[model samples]
Target: MSLLALTAFAAAATASVPVHSVALDHRGGTYKVDYRAAVETRARTIGMSAGTRPSTQRCIMTATVSVDRIIADGGHELHARVPGEKTFTRNLPGDCRGRAEQLTALVEDRQPAIGAHLAAAAASDRQHALAAIDAAHNLASN
Candidate 1:
């Protein structure tokens, strides 16, 4: 049936990609880019085979402050928050102030949405893997 085929395709697509891995090619900040790269690396290590990360452990995500010359021509106020911390304030230098602020704003805006997606996907994968292990253990014991 067409419905069955569609369902199969959907599952395959979902399996092929990590659920919350970000694809932000356009909004690359020097700091945000490096931060995102690390998250992407960790995302790849997850899934059915790679196994779940330990529950208690946590890691910092990095974001740097840098300006793009084109955007920096018109200076703007900047504010940004890194992951799991209160918003940090900065007094940027005059030359790249506009660019730096723009980058920070983009990073702060994108970080939460992306972080949420990654967290949810990672958790779902973790629970699914745990359930599979439990089922396998019971089957083996029987």
Candidate 2:
């Protein structure tokens, strides 16, 4: 192949793919207290059987929110991710299944609360953006 043709082919093959960058605009806000109640309710609803001998378990719930800025449209996009972990012990195999079910129920019941919290946080972020815009406008007008 000709040198020029080979060089052209190599360049085309090596051309970098367009990459997009994402930024998260997070805001701090308080979540509704009812979420905790829902979680407790779920736990009770999935309660263990009689003489099941109460067992101690540890669980952690982690939630994350991400917001995307659309430069062209001048709008923000919000997203949420909820993750949880659990550790427990049970005597019978059936009890183990019940415990698993309880955990799942707990997570399911709290989903609404998690979503509410994310929405609240996103609203807070929008408030921040508005405040910034107002500040800039005020400065520009002065």
Candidate 3:
């Protein structure tokens, strides 16, 4: 194959693969995780326990991530590479699985940074709450 043809083929293959995108929903005040297929797993899910904000005052939110492999050929077996059998096998699309190692690394890489930022925010919120109480008490006494 000519070099130009090979380059085109590589670009096409790369374009076919999905990319991971993760962000915090600051405007809506929600925590959501989105990821592309990993190296060994597809449909990587990163989430937290429902109802706990990462910066929720007085609580530390934990990120829960799992990589799932979808069963092929009209099967409904979903395999978890990170959750360790915690995820019940459900119907999943074939294109979901990618690389488990990559997803794991993403989780590990993000958790600490997010935790630190949220920790600071939570502390600030706590301080504000305490100050409000103090101001209210002083007003009532006066």
Best candidate (score: lDDT): 2
lDDT of 1 by residue, 26-130 (tens): 223211111111221100011122246533322222233221111111232112222332222323322221232333343455455545544544434443333
Displacement of residue 90 (Cα, Å) in model 1 is: 22
lDDT of each: 0.30, 0.33, 0.32
TM-scores of the candidates in the order shown:
0.22, 0.26, 0.23
Best model per TM-score: 2
The TM-score that candidate 2 achieves is: 0.26
Deviation in Å, model 1, residue 114 alpha carbon? 2.3
Over 4 Å off in model 1, which ranges? 1-98, 127-142
Better of 2 and 3 by lDDT: 2
RMSD of 3: 23.1
* Cα lDDT tens digits for candidate 2, 37-112: 1121111123334566764433322212222322111332222222332222222223221344444443444455
How far out, in Å, is residue 104 in model 3? Answer: 2.1
Sorted on lDDT, best first, the list reads 2, 3, 1
